[model samples]
Target: MSKVRVAVIGCGSISKHRHIPEYADNSNVELVAFVDPVIERAEEYAAKHGGKAYADYETMLAEVKPDAVSVCTPNYLHAPMSIAAANAGAHVLVEKPMAVTDEEAAAMNEAAAKNGVKLMVGHNQRLMPPHVKAKQILDSGVLGKVLTFRTSFGHPGPDGWSIDGAGSWFFRKNEAIMGAMGDLGVHKSDLIRYLLSDEVSEVAAFIATIDKPGDVDDNANVIVRMKSGAIGSLVASWTYYKGEDNSTVLWCEKGVMKIGTHPEDQVIVELRDGSVEKHKVGEISTNTKQLSSGIVDAFIDSIINDTVPAISGEEGRKSLKVILSAFESQATGQFIKVN
Candidate 1:
């Protein structure tokens, strides 16, 4: 098949750091257009990446009609932009925390199915080597049935990562909605579900905005009950002053598994039989390295092969439901059922 024509709908840090670069490197992809409210930003990326710059995404979508489009805009814009891209006859790959609410997420999924276009979410944690191995191990029953889990994903904050320092859209309640829970919590929710092959059934949470000078939450501590009768603790923070702490530990019937926690190994497996194994899974993307995500390549390949994306819109919605339900749990001071 000929190269897949692609457009990037947001020229933010994520697009510049991951999406644009990965798509450019893929021999099967042709960058066709770049869109950003700040037209100059789009122009800069277009000049370097071989695409036209547009201040308006609708205009670009109508004109270019790309085969695929990546939506890397603020949290609030994810659903509308993805639905628009699908409606314009383009497959969509959108950033995570798919939408702020279940209704919006459902709309996105419906739009994609209606248009016969695939929709994938950028839940990059699922693409990590160690996490992938953990899934395999769990499926093999080597760890037996997972009984409990503790997972955390934290960093200084998006002020340092987003293109607009301090005043980034991530700090805006209107745009980002739930802050740390939506930003980092959603990732852990998705990873836990993926690792155990279970859905989050209920959540009781203490979501707060501590230390971060914003109305949105900077800290989220949640207790979750999975459909498989497994319980877990999930913590997402923006006040990890020391550095990032992306880690998860699962306690199973026969053994324990550690991911992204230890210094030497990416995954550490210890069994009751006094046997231990260390897996040197490759490094995942960091701020300094900003390594390729492999998401763009997967999206392009799924289109070429005429298959559904591994992280489909429906899957993305399920993950979003976990976070949104956490917020509701915090507000009600009780466990919120994830439906």
Candidate 2:
């Protein structure tokens, strides 16, 4: 296909600010449809982007027959929508925390396989230049073996970013499941795995609904042990009153690496030998205006080249496993093993 026909299944803030705009910028994609339960929202986007507005995604899939679909719906709807899109003969680019449960994620994976379509999850952190460089540095083994690390992702709350603001589906437990953990922790989980090229073996956590207006957790402190024998702490919080903090510090045998810790420096590396290397790899997007996640470009490039997406369905599932295991650990008050 010279130009992949694309449909986006959600007209929320994410779709409006990131996916839709990015797809329009990509020369290899032709925006064909926009879907949302709220017809007005879909109509608004469709009017602006030159596509049909759809209240029902299945109908859009049947009529448009898009070559690729971006699933940006609520957390609970991700799996089913992605599966439906895949079954309709479209490659899928699903938003993260692939699904609320492993079963649902596995079902989505199966459906994609059955339909002979590519399934990628929106683990955008892995595409960041600094994170990619960090992966390269770690893979080179110059830091010796990674010993331990602390990674965190936090912000004031979704009220500032969600399409519905304070009344967003993110605050509802049934829709979001676990708020901060699912929203932010999963991103870190995917990032850690990418940086170290290791999977988490166990998790112990303290998750709480501290100072958020809903039933879901606002803060989570999780300790994890990696299969590579490295230990680390993963924190997700909606109570970061100061500002957004999306940073990771990896302590290796010979040195340490800091990622997304400062506005001026994207990656900071310091060795025990008193040597320091600071990488100014641009800035991370903190708001909608700056949402150049490199996600849409990568997704379109993968389709154009017929190559596997960097963050595949199984890769997304592995990251979800970390967050789910943390929830289990919090409930059991013990370290939970990851499958």
Candidate 3:
């Protein structure tokens, strides 16, 4: 297909800021439909982006038959919506924490594979410019060996970003599954794996609903041990009242690599020789500043080229596994092995 017909399954903040805009910006994509339970929400985006709005996504899939669909709905709806789209012969670009359970994630992947369609997960951190450069540097073996690391993603809350604001599904335990961990911690789980190219062997965590008015946790602190024996802490919170903090610091044998930490520098590497290297690769997308996530471009390219998506369903599942283990750890008060 020269131009892939695209449909967005959610008209919320993510779809509004990232999926719809980025897909519309891509020359290879033709916006064909927008779906949302709230008819007005769907209609609003459809009017602006030139697509038929539908209150039901299954109906949209049947009617529009889009070449690709982005599942930007809540965590609970991700697996079903993606599977439905895939079964209808549409490629899928699903949001992170693809499913609430491993079985659901596996089923979504199975559906996409059975239908011969691509299933890309929206692990945008892996596509961020700074992260891409960091991966390149790590892969080059310039940094001797990673010994420990700390990665964090936090902001005031999703209250300001969600289309529904404070009433969004994000604060609902049934819809969102886990609050900050599902929303942000999963992103870091995927990023750590991508940059280090290693699987998490075990995890221990402390999860709490410190501030948010929800049954789900608003704060999570996870300790992970990678297969390569490197240890790290992953923090996800909705309590960073000051500002957003999406940063990662890796302590290697030869030096330390810090990502998204400095105000101006995207990456900073301090070597043991008393020398430092700073890189300004590009801006990382934040809750306040909506930058091109590069996820849309990659998804479209995969469709046009018939290549596997940069972040596939299995990759998403692996990341989800880490988060799942952390949850188990929180409940059991012991280190849980990542299966």
Q: Per-residue alpha-carbon lDDT of model 3 for 1-339, expressed as tens digits?
A: 468999999889999889988988998888999999898999998889898999999889988999999999999999989999999999999998999999999999999999999999999999899999999988888888899999999999989788888998999988898899999999999999999999999999999998888788999999999999999999999989998999999999999999999878999999999999999999889988889999999999988888999999999999999999999999999989997
Question: What TM-score does each of the candidates earn?
Answer: 0.98, 0.98, 0.99
The whole-model lDDT of each prediction reads 0.91, 0.90, 0.93
lDDT of 1: 0.91
Candidate 2: tens digits of C-alpha lDDT, residues 1-339: 579899999999889788998999988888999999999999988888798999999899999999999999899999989998988899999998899999999999999899989899999889878888888888888899999999999999889889899999999998988799999999999999988888999999999998989799999999989999999999999889887888999999999999888788899999999999999976666763465889998888888888988899999999999999999998989889997
Against the true structure, candidate 2 has what lDDT?
0.90
Find the number of clashing residue pairs for candidate 2.
0
Superposed by TM-score, candidate 2 places the C-alpha of residue 228 at a distance from the truth, in angstroms, of 0.8
Model 2 segments more than 4 A misplaced: none
Candidate 1's C-alpha runs over 4 A off are none
The weakest ten consecutive residues by lDDT in model 2 span 282-291
Count of clashes, each model: 0, 0, 0
Q: Write the per-residue lDDT of candidate 1 for residues 189-268, one digit (tens) a residue.
A: 99998999899999999999889887999999999999999998999999897878889999999999999887669899
